[model samples]
Target: MDARVDDKVVLVTGASRGIGEAVAAEFLASGARGVVITSRKANNVEAAAERLGEPDRVLALAARSDSVDDAD
Candidate 1:
């Protein structure tokens, strides 16, 4: 399937590790122009972004998925 996510900005929650991390990577591989990854811990979010190795394309934010304010 061709996702055609190229140049699209994607927001992924719980992206510090596991499936979330995998999904973020897949989006990058699929040619997404920007990927916003979120996790509860700020450090983890930054780490994940570094691991992705695309500072220009990846943005990391610390947020709780259940929190409405965090989503904003």
Candidate 2:
């Protein structure tokens, strides 16, 4: 597949697991320049980012998906 997201930035919620994680991975594979991943727990987000193995390209943030304040 082509790197459609080349040089683009992506934000992914609930990225600790499931479909969100998959989307994040796909974005990276498609050549995103940066990816921000969020989850309710800091530890889970950190772990997921670590597992993604692209420290310079990935950022992990803790935020509740149901809360608007957290999203800000």
Candidate 3:
């Protein structure tokens, strides 16, 4: 479990809950420098990040798979 992700960056989609959330947590635990999580519901993503105790490490953005660039 020595991934040593000290400066890794990960982008996770559909991360409000379920597998995506799990993956994000793992990345953080592995010492990732940053993680960006995207979901249709902005509030959910924000809440999840806050609960994880590193709100600044996560970027919660609204996105739709088909369209791309929902933040625009």
Candidate 4:
């Protein structure tokens, strides 16, 4: 672990699982101030967030990357 993210906010897309989830976890492990995870499936991202096990430090949002509305 390093101070690379000491107090920085991180946004990880497609984070419901796979590489995105791993990245989000790493950010937390590396000491990020907070992490915002997004995915097309609401349930999936929410579960992924919970799995990260840092409720206070993680925010999960269901958003389709290709959707203009979701982007907003």
Best model number under lDDT: 4
Q: Which 10 consecutive residues of model 1 have the lowest summed lDDT?
A: 63-72
Local distance difference test, each candidate: 0.92, 0.91, 0.81, 0.93
Q: lDDT per residue, candidate 1, 1-60, as tens digits?
A: 268898899999999998998899999999999999999999998999999999999999
> Which pairs of residues have clashing backbones in candidate 3?
none
CA RMSD (A), model 3: 4.3
Error at 12, model 1, angstroms = 0.5
Output the TM-score of candidate 4. Answer: 0.86
In order, what is each prediction's RMSD in angstroms? 3.8, 3.8, 4.3, 3.7
Q: Across residues 5-69, which tens digit of lDDT does each residue of candidate 3 receive?
A: 78878888888888988888888989899998888887888877876677778777877645657
Best model number under TM-score: 1
TM-score of 1: 0.86
Error of 1 at 61 (Å): 0.2
Off by over 4 Å in 4: 1-3, 67-72
User: Model 3: runs farther than 4 Å from truth?
Assistant: 1-4, 66-72
For model 1, what is the alpha-carbon lDDT of residue 53?
94
After superposition, which runs of candidate 2 have C-alpha atoms over 4 Å from their true positions?
Answer: 1-3, 67-72
Ranking by lDDT: 4, 1, 2, 3
